[model samples]
Target: MQATRVLLELAGNVVLLLWGLHMVQSGLTRALGGDLRRILGAGLRNRWTAFLSGMGITMLLQSSTATGLMATGFTANGLVSLMPALAVMLGANVGSTLIVQVLAFDVTHVAPVLLLGGFLAFRRGGRTRSRDLGRVAIGLGLMLLSLHLLVATIAPAENAPMLRRMLGMLTADPVVAVLLAAILSWAAHSSVAAILLIASLAGGGVIGPEAAVAMVAGANLGSAINPIVEGPGGDGHNPAARRLPVGNLVNRIAGCLIVLPLLGPITAGLQTLSPDATRLAANFHLAFNLAMAALFIGPLPWFARVLTRLFPERVAVADPGMPLYLDRSALRVPHLAIANAAREALRMADAVDSMLRGALDVLHSDDRKRVQEIRRMDDVLDRLHDAIKHYLTQINVEDLDERDARRVSDVLTFTINLEHVGDIVDRNLMEAASKKIRRKLRFSTEGAAEIAGMLERLSETQRLAAAVFVSGDIRSARALMREKEVIRDLETSATEAHFARLRAGRTESVETSALHLDILRDLRRINAHLVAAAYPVLDQSGELLPSRLKHGATHG
Candidate 1:
């Protein structure tokens, strides 16, 4: 009964530690997720810089898993090269150890202070970021408190012969010890928590230093496994998505292979450096990662080449309708989720652009096959729109700050407008082209040029819409709105010119006058939909007028 009670208490304390670590990771991710992504995106210029970036981000995030996810997303999207991303994994491993190093110290006295301060700030802080930072403080306090509790609970169990014998069995085989730690770390999905648990057990004299060191190695190996297993597979065909995580796992395994044989000497060296079992465990964790970083950092470029060959990018023969960047795993991180949605939305815009260009070809060539292709393109747009919409809805509302919420709305609106553009091209514009082809009608040379001009202008606006969607640049948004007016003026002028050609009694204009007017109006409508992407951005910046009408003037 006493052993069971002690075991339950130990489990509870471990749960508290894991919860505290979660708060730290989620809090920091919510507060600085975008800036951290930008930092990683900008700093991954080379292996060395990528290493630093990875370390810094993981230090803030407190979980190497989060860092691995971010790095994987980058490489999968082709935003960064594999060599730099691999370096980031190395740095992230080292960063996770730093957290353990801090926790390994006897800072139980500071726990109460952190808890009190965090509670007040979290409940009273005015800004969201402030509240998020407060949450980080609270997590730190809980982690410290749990460690204190964990040590107290283990103190009584150290004298238990059953516990000692159980631990002794594992100590008999270093490989088994390492595997046990790896499984614990993998199951927890957090090496920091696993190592902290190992550290607590060591410090409490319930486990020997040799056993602790072996567990640390196992824990490190286990931590890398979650990312590979849980990461987005890019619809299960893109092997490039696995390269970064695989490279990280390989690095951990190599380090473990090197250290496992030297466990006796390494444990002795660690003990000489620190007699405290907790400190010894923390130091070993740090030393193992640093050694891995040094060993793998130089061969990264060459290693990248090897991985690329192994996972060779298969030619993407997949369906165009599938969502490519809406990574389901990203829904836990609001900023990353929004970015993924935005990327998917861009794919929608690209499909719409294709439809617009195809509509122009159908107008001139009257090719039945091109018209069918344009209709299929609209179907692709619809699928992409639905995928983005559902993906954004999956992101937890509470996880999103005001800024991220606005971004979600913007991505949805952009994709919605592009879908409308696709509809115009397929239903209205293409139908007009079909009528001309069926009736064997041709416009006057002047009318054909006018129609071509309108299509060209709408396409240009669409290109700008994609830019505005990504950057949300006020200047570009304003330019997109201005293009709306340009397209409208061109439509009005072309309508009048077509009528003038009719008045001149041109037979071709008379035969195709109605189709000419329909084509012009549909092109103008498509431009309106394209420029709608700018309104949200302009409204958010307070640059857009609520009403274009003159100050409450009455309409007759």
Candidate 2:
């Protein structure tokens, strides 16, 4: 019963530590999420930049695993190359050890002050920034307090006969000790928590310096395990994205393997720097990650190439089926998330473009099989449109600047328009073509030429809208807006000409009069949808007006 009570206390302390770490991670993510992404995205110029940025982000986040996950998502999306990403992970590994290093010192007295200050600041919040900063403060305070609790809880274990016996065995067999620590670290989901516990055990003199060093190595290796589980699945998942987590695991295991045999010498050497057992263990963690980072940072390109060979891209993977850049992990960073959404919007436009081309194909050939296939393409557009909408909505607009908010609105408007265009093709134009084919009706040669010309023009307009969406260039957007007026004029003239042909006693024109007019109306509406992508850009530049007509003044 006494042992059970003691174990319960230990469990509570560990839970407290984990909760504190969670608060810090969540707080920082909400407070400076966009800036963090911008920094990460902008810093990937080379391996050195990647490494430094990784370290900087990890220090701010206080979790290497989160940094690794974000980087993995980027790699999966092809935003950052594997070599630069690996360099950042190296830096993150080093940065993740900072918590343990800080804990080895005596800062327990500051916890109450931090807790009070954090609570007050959090209560005073007007936006997420202040609240998130308070959250970090509270988490850091809890961490320091938990460290004190951890040492006190473990100190009594030295007098327990059963616990003492277990420690004796772990000290005698470093391999067994490491495996035990590694498993616990993975289960706990926080290396900082595991390392803090080990450091406390060292402080209590329940474990020697050598065993603590071995345990620290195991803890670091286990740190990479979470990323492995979080990565893309083996099947129906992104091959490139899975590599970051796997590669991170590889780095940890390899570093531990090399250092395991040298534990006796390394621990002995580190002992000279500190007679305190806890500091010795902390130093070993800092040393091990730094060495591994320096050793692997340069060869990351070769490493990435090898990983790609191992997980080759699937030959069957096609566009319009999977999202190219709409990564949920990116939502924390509004800028990257918006950029990803824009790319996905472009992909949706391409799918719509294909459907338009198919409608044109059905005009001359009337291939039932091909028309059916093209009609099904709208399903892909519908799914992608929903996906892009959900992704953009996940971004916290309250956290965004005016510029970013405008960018997000642009993406939303563009996807909505693309979806509308897709519906017009599937329900309106495809049906018209099917009816004409079913009745064995042939359009007059002039009508055929006119419809074909209009279809070709619509396709060109779609291509321009796609470019404008991605580039957000003012000139291109204005051109797209102008093209809308051109499409309207063409539709009006085509309709008038159809009536003229009907009055001339052209049998083909009279026979297919309804289908020809219906097709022209739908095509004009589709053009209007495609041109909507430019409205945001044109509005922002003051080159376009909200309502294209004067309210008070009328034209004669």
Candidate 3:
């Protein structure tokens, strides 16, 4: 009964540690996620910078798995090259160990201070960023408290015969120790937590240094596995997308295989670095990764070439109308599901953009084929919007926090707007183009130029709307609204100019009068659909006016 109680307490402490780590990860992701993405994007220029960027981001996030996901997503999207992504993974490994280095010391005294300050900030802070930072502080405090409790619980069991016998077996066979730690770390989805537990046992003298070192190797291997299993491009359908995760796991496996045979020498060397068992285990974890980084960083380009050959990008023969990022597995994780939905939403925007560009071509060329093509593209948008709506609705709303819930609504709104934009291009503008083609009608030169100008601006607004959808920046959203005004002015001027042409009895204007006006109206309507993406963002920031009416003025 006593042993069972000890095991249960140990498990509970580990749970608390995992929870704290989760809070830290989720908070930092919300607070600095965009900045980190920009920083990571900028840093991927070369291997050295990519390595440092990966380490810095993982350190901030406190989860290399999260860093891996970001890196993998960038690779899958063609945003960055595989070589630099591999370098980032190496840096992330080193960064994850730095957290262990800090926690290896006795820092339990600051827990209450952190908890008190964090609680006050979370309750009293007005800004979202402040609240997120407060959450980070609270997570840090919980982590320290859990570690303190873990040590206190384990200290009394140091001499328990059952505990000693179990640990003795682990110390006797380092292979079993490594495998056990790997399983625990994988199940927890956190090497940081797993290693902390192992270190605590070593510090408590319940396990020897060799067993702890073996377990550290296992923890490293285990953490790398989660990304390949659960990340964005992890489905085997896209081998190119799995390159970064698989490469990262390869490094971990190599490091473990190399260290296992040299356990005695490695543990002895680690002991020389730190006399305390906990610090010794932590040092080994750091040194192992640093060595891996040194050995692998330079050959990343060549290693990338090898991985590419092994997992060449397959020609996508699948229907383009099918959803790309909406993995059913991600629905269990609300944030991941949100990200998947966002990516799929972007696809809708992409189709709309193509339709806008094609609309300009059809209006100028009177191409029958282009009109048919634009209509087909509208079908793609409808399918994507439907898929996104169904996928998002499948996510349990009870599982979403305020931020995640807001993200879902934003993605749905953006996709719906894009779908409407597609309708304007296909049903209105394309139909007008088809009428002109069928009747052998042409626009007056002045009217053609005006229609082209509006179409150009519509395309620009679509791009801005996409940017707003992804970044949610208030300034960008405001700028998108400004473009809406510009488009409205263009439409009004085009209407007046068309009236002037009609009054002058311009032959081409008289011939295609209705078609020219329809084109102008449809272009303006499409602009409105594109601009709808910004309204929600501006409203949330309190930058949007409730209405354009004067104060207390009634609308009949």
lDDT of each: 0.86, 0.82, 0.86
Per-residue lDDT tens digits of candidate 1, residues 49-74? 99999999999999877887788888
Model 3: how far is 167 from its true place, Å?
5.1
After aligning candidate 1 to the native by TM-score, how far in Å is the CA of 239 from where it should be? Answer: 1.8
Score candidate 1 by TM-score against the native. Answer: 0.88
Alpha-carbon TM-score of each model against the true structure: 0.88, 0.79, 0.78
- Which regions of candidate 3 are displaced past 4 Å? 163-172, 272-275, 317-319, 322-347, 356-372, 386-408, 423-528, 537-544, 549-556
Candidates' RMSD to native: 3.8, 4.9, 5.5
Q: Show the lowest summed lDDT stretch of 10 residues, model 3.
A: 547-556
lDDT of 3 at 514: 90
| Full-model lDDT, candidate 1 | 0.86
Candidate 2 wrong stretches, greater than 4 Å: 77-81, 112-134, 155-172, 236-243, 298-320, 326-342, 364-370, 382-420, 444-506, 524-556
